[model samples]
Target: MLTVALPKGALLKDSIRLLQSVGLDFSAFLDSGNRQLQIQDPTQTAQGLLVRAQDVPVYVEYGQAQLGIVGFDVLQEKKPQVAQFADLGFGHCRMSVAVPSQSPYRSAMELPPNCRVASKFVHCAHDFFSKIDLPVEIIPLYGSVELGPITGMSEAIVDLVSTGRTLKENGLIELDCLYDSTARLIAHPLSYRLNQYNLEHWLNEISKNSQPLAAKAS
Candidate 1:
């Protein structure tokens, strides 16, 4: 059976909706009382695995799932060896450098070299700094990265910003936007190449029913 890895948070509903448009319904994952991490589509053509957004690529790369849905940010941070197929176009957000509102630094470059920048997306943070030729310490903060700057533990934070509500509430200001992120379709290369379990047919159906890559979906 073709197994799909579905992200568990904000993107869940949209992902299920996208799959439904292509004739696979995994909406059971969205039920308020549903507890099963793994659910088979009612049609018996495929199954879904509910997992953290960050782990979607991991499952696909390892062949535990032949296909997955995850945010572009997670793919950049994890860099798992999966074939990136399409951007599902929901979950709009951006990865940004943020600092305390009163901080002297106005941009990522203004921060002193080697200053501590906290984030859960350390890899993405590191690459951004490296591209700009800035040297800084990337602190890995799994929970509440805004605290890094708030508590004076770090000079800034590299994290996702959606609508800027959280940043505004915390008195943090965006210094620079690293990149925008959205949900994307990823597939295991081998499974995709072999078209196992009629995977190509499903993908074709999805492609026809959904927007093409890089096109935003409502």
Candidate 2:
């Protein structure tokens, strides 16, 4: 049976919805009290593995899972051996560099050499700063990165920003956007080669249904 890895959290519901649209049902895993990590979807001849978003690509790249749904942010950091099949287009956000609203550093380039920035995504932060020729000290923070700038722990932060409410509440403002991120469908290259027919069919089905929703004009 085919095995798929799915991120466990806010993206889970949307991931399941997309899979269900392509005839894979994982409603059982959605129950509040359901703690099953592996769920069998008999109707679709597949199994689902619930995993952390950061670990999804690892599972797929190692051939443990034939496919996975994960964020672009994780992919940028990991760069695992997987074929990025389709952009699921949901879970939209931006990876950005943010600083305290009151700071004199208005842009990423305005920072003095060797300034510090905090983030859970250390690799991403490093790459972004390097591209702009900004020498930075990367302080890795697991959570509440917004506080990095507010509390003077770091000069800025590189993190995922959706609504900007968190930054506003923490007295921070985005200095520069690193990348636009969304959930993507990825497959192990070997698995795709081994199960070409089935994998191709699945990819086509998902791509067909995953088109961006049209904007309603005012």
Candidate 3:
């Protein structure tokens, strides 16, 4: 059976919806009491594996799952061996460089060399700074990076920002957007090549249905 790695957080609902559109049903994951990590479509055509958003690619790359739904940020951070097949276009956000609103640095480039920047995404942060030839100490922080600047543990932070609200509440401001992120459909490289479980047909269907929704003009 075709097995999919479904993300367990914010993107889960839409990922399930997209799969449903293509004729797979893993809706049991939505029930408040449904704690099962693995589920099967009623039709027995496929199965779903609920996993951490960051671990989606890991499962797919290891061949435990033929496909996965995950954020672009995770793909970049993990650098897993998988095929990035489609931009599913949900869970939109950005990777940014931010600092305290009152900080002297107004832009990423202006930050002093060896400045400390805390982030859960150390690799992404390092790559961003390297492009500008700015050497920084990227503190690997796995939780609440905004506190880095507020607590004086770091001069800045490299983190994902969905809205400026969190930063504002913490007296932080975004200095630069490194990249925009969205949910993407990824597959195991060998599985994709082998056309395992006839994955291509479902991929085409999902691709046709999940284009980024258009914003209605006022």
Candidate 4:
């Protein structure tokens, strides 16, 4: 049976909607109060596994799932070994550097050498700082990265910003955007080769549906 991993957070609803367009009804998983991670489709041709957004890639890479839907941020941060099949185009956001609005640091370069930078995405932050030649200390935080600047734990933060509202509420402002991200469809390479016909057909259908939605969103 074909298996797909779906992230459980922001992208979940849209992911289910997209899959339903391709004849996969995942509503039971969404509606059921069941805490079970794996849900079987009535047809039994495919199954859906609910997982952490960050772990979706891990499942696909390990062949635990034939396909997975997750955000580009996780792909960038994890750098997992998998073939990215389609940009699902939902869950849009950007990874950015932000600091307290009143801070003197106006740009990436303006940050003093070796200043502490906090983020859940340590590798992404490291690469970005390296490219800009701004040497810094990395202080990893699990959640609420906005607290980094507020508490003086770090001079700046690298985190996903969906809207400016969270930053504004925290008295922080975006310093520079690192990357624009959206959810994407990813597949294990071997699984794609083995299920080539069905997977390609599925992807093409989703892409066709996505164009209109993208236009509407724009």
lDDT of 2 at 75: 96
**What are the Cα lDDT values of the candidates?**
0.90, 0.87, 0.91, 0.88
Which consecutive 10 residues in model 3 have the weakest lDDT in total?
209-218
Give, for candidate 2, the lowest lDDT window spanning 10 residues: 209-218
Better of 1 and 4 by lDDT: 1
What would the TM-scores of all predictions be? 0.95, 0.95, 0.96, 0.95
For TM-score, candidate 2 versus 4, the one ahead is: 4
Q: How far in Å is the alpha carbon of 81 misplaced in model 1?
A: 0.5
Name the regions of candidate 1 deviating beyond 4 angstroms: 212-218
| Pairs in clash, predicted candidate 3 | none
Residue 48, candidate 4: Cα error in Å is 0.3
Q: TM-score: which candidate is best?
A: 3
Who is ahead in lDDT, 2 or 3?
3
lDDT string for model 1 (59-167, tens) is 9999999999899999999899999887677888999999999989998989999999999999999999999999999999889999998888999999999999999
Let me know the TM-score candidate 1 reaches against the reference structure: 0.95
lDDT tens readout by residue for model 3, 1-218: 89999999999998999888888999999999998999999999999999999989989999999999999999888888899988887888999999998988889999999999999999999999999999999999989999898889999999999977999999998999999898899999898888889988877777777864312110
